[model samples]
Target chain A: MSELLIATHGLTKVYRGGVTAVDHVDLEVRAGDVYGFLGANGSGKTTTVRMLLGLVLATEGGIELFGEAMPKAGASVLPRVGALVEGPGAYPHLSGRANLTLLDSTDGRRRRGDRRRRVGEVLEQVGLDPADRRPVRTYSLGMRQRLGLASALLRRPPLLVLDEPTNGLDPQGIREMRELLLSLNRAGTTIFLSSHLLAEIEQMSSRVGVLDRGRLVLQEDLATLQAPTGLVRVRTPDLSTALRLLDGQVVDRGEGHLVVRSPDAAALNAHLVARDVRVTELGPERRSLEEIVLAASESA
Target chain B: MIRVELVKLLTRPRTWITILALNALPTLVAVLLAVTDLGPRPGTGPPFLSAVLTDGTLFPLAALGIVLPLFLPVAVAVVGGDAIAGEVQSDTLRYLLVRPVSRLRLLVAKLVSVVVFVVLAVLAVAVVAYVEGRLLLGDAPATGVVSVSGSTLTQAEMTQRTGLAFVYVVLAMLGVAAIALFFSTLTDSAVGAALGTIGVLVASTVLLGLDAADAIKPYLMTRHWLAFVDLFRDPIRWGDVVDGVLTQLGYLVVFAGAAWANFATKDVNR
Candidate 1:
């Protein structure tokens, strides 16, 4: 019930050979929030998650889960956090049901007889057949992903941390995973996941944190980030003069229209009008989430 | 968590396959010896083959000898090396370690599982060899082998020696298992871990051949592997057997410790 389910102070990780995977990242995920971590491949997103989970040692800084200091408290705190990081991490020779049962038995809090029911429930929830006895090695990429999700849900923990839960899923599989995650979040599990799929994050996340290179560049609610990007597509009779007057400002020039982005489109139009530039067509345009993210990453 | 480790170990067809394959050599030896009747004079063929030809009870002993030098130990190496390395290769260590269990605790579970595997493998060799020997070569009258004290022992004494001898073999292989587990913790490649474990043993065996290694030979993990032979000797020569036990214990301690320290500090990037 802590305010922040996860918090980090100056968290950093430097691998051998002097490669810094994560650099002084300070992050917070409040309780009951679906926090999406977005980054390009090899953008230190996985490394940050690993550090938070105590799977990787941090070169500097500290982390806390449920108000307890990490690594030190990870053992005590981990049973309350379910996770699927990067790989299926499943025993290929065991059936899907067998895999979940085996993993569930590891939890100290797992009750007698509750294990089978929990495993069965998770299997059904993940859309896998409860009675399927096929080994995991024979499963398709999507099935393996579902199995991974099933393992994370085995405990029904308060927090579910997944890394690229939709990495290799097909369109339908992706949608299923998205809906499953949304439902889990709705049921009060604070979900923290990382993915390179910006649009997926935009659709599924209530809040998002962006990682570029090795640093956390931006963290904001999707509502705030999805705000009308204040982009205005304007065409003027004197295009050259409009360009001059708009110097030192952010602008994108298209074939016919000059794209100007600002918080207020009316003010931009008034300034252009005062400059004696006869505007032909002016309309406010909103930027998509992908475009906004692309802009941020490009500038980084 | 240990239960999880056991279930995982048991459900794999590879586990039973490894055990069956390990028993293959002894089974082959039994069938060949029974048919050919070509008695490989004492100390010539295998350590206990001559006895196996005469006494069905000794067939299990002969099987142990065949496997101890190569077969069973290799299986142990495979299983032990695959302990964490297999998980790492499959990227399952990330999931396993994220549970409530600590790295050391997981390592212990894995080590215990490997030990259970070794015990099962050794016992398989013994049981199958016993049945094969009993059916093909035939058992002896409750009489036992002659003791160094120059006295023939009873069935009880022989059975006791057999049990002690098997236990000693398990301990000896614990050295190899620990070594393999250490390498398993060191690498993410399961094949490399298994091969690396076997590679070190092979190198040590090769070293035991050099005249310069005489002083260190006694300390080699491979040196005391056949000490189980001493248990079969008259008067039960405890000297070499005890030394082997101590040497194996020493290796297990050092190597198990090394595996622990390395695994504890390792970053589970895979």
Candidate 2:
């Protein structure tokens, strides 16, 4: 098995006033995978991330990062993980470069040339000019988001945990953030990010785990889950021919219609047409991430 | 860690502005004393004011004395109060804590920053007053100190005692600093922290003023704040000054310890 960079065993967290924020979540993110944590606004996504970082205490479960138990090993484990929780919080009075430099000074690592050069490099990496002398308070919201990402990337660790990383970015900035994350993933960094934007996750993540009301509803690879979960219902005068062409993939049978499950519904339609079967209806039947989460939360 | 915090303190405009505002009272005292020579004689005014007019180097002690009652303590309260709460309010404490820095060390660094701020503010007022005193009051060497028993001490000894007085004043400010820092961990609002710390001091001072509360006065942080004045006595009355230093050191230990304890377990959602 690929090394699991992040693994939690029945991790749970219950806040004050008897509120269960996260309940028995057994989550896993392997090495070299962009694992997207999908959830609703208050579905315990941020709380889970905070627990993984040892920022918040877990009520009843265990969390291990890189095979070491955290928060006991938080000193050793946290250094190897880079995170951007909420948009980066900067000293509004200091220039962007100054803010990053101050944060970099706290890193316990070997010196790799002058610190100023590294600050400049990360600033340029995030598309922010290091020479910009304006204080962070003067930067636009998108600029702050970019600066937040730059701060996260400063350490260049093996795992990057981000919470709503593309929060305030415009479309162009979001695409750039997506590209940056993808490039980072390609370079062998395991990226675990949480977001409610399904399209963003679908486009970026290799595997996904959906959290609904403090519980994991689904966890699967994008490709594996891409297969249609149900069947496309079709009605036609030559339904018997369509049924014969679909083989044994039928999910439902009726008098003059048949329901079949297939990822390639277009290919099935072509096959039916080649056999001279008239088709009245055809479409893929799969639940969207949004609908799945909504259903799971409502049920909870 | 201290270096990072110092950089943060120096970079903020609010820091400089606070220092300037704190220094204002001393500058006014220096200017008012220079003009008209309408200074209060010994035993007629606050600590060290009469002696300050003759010797320029003595003005720093006088400045600290003038501000210590409420002005300097309030400045210390404001700086210490803002240290952690300001970061929490701005949400930058999360980034700082996420680094390899532990909560204890972070708190230590914050406390150190407040100490550094106190030193800087005191020195700013002292330096400006020293210059203003030298320019306005002329370079008269400090006169001899007359003891209550009619003994005299040299000017060099007087300067040395004044040095100790400045150092003691800084130590006194640490009591307020420690309390403010402790409150800083309790709330996310800087203003709330400042007010809370100052409120405790105000209540203590009020109790100190009440004879019915005389039994608890020795233990109160406010009681020993003005004890730095004892350093100027010809015999150098060490009794109250010693109690004052010990009282502040005790506050530092208790309050700073509590701040660390509270912050280490904080969820830090902000």
Highest lDDT: which candidate?
1
Backbone clashes counted, model 2: 0
Give a tens-digit lDDT track for model 2, residues A78-145.
Answer: 88898888777998888998898889997646473687888887888889994446899999888998
DockQ class, candidate 1 = medium
Model 1 agreement with the true structure over A234-272: per-residue lDDT tens digits: 887788898888876646987657988677888998999
Q: List runs of model 1 lying over 4 Å from the truth.
A: A229-284, B138-140, B148-150
* The 10-residue segment with the lowest total lDDT in model 1 chain B: B141-150
- Candidate 1 accuracy as TM-score: 0.90
The residue-by-residue lDDT of candidate 1 on B1-270, one tens digit each, is 788788888888999999999989888888888899876887687777876667877789888888888878788888998999898887788888888678988989998999999888889989999999889985666556755355777778888988998899888888888989999999987788889989988988999999988998888888988878777667788898999999988988999999999999889888
Q: What tens digits encode model 2's per-residue C-alpha lDDT throughout B183-229?
A: 99999999999999899889999998899998889989989877777
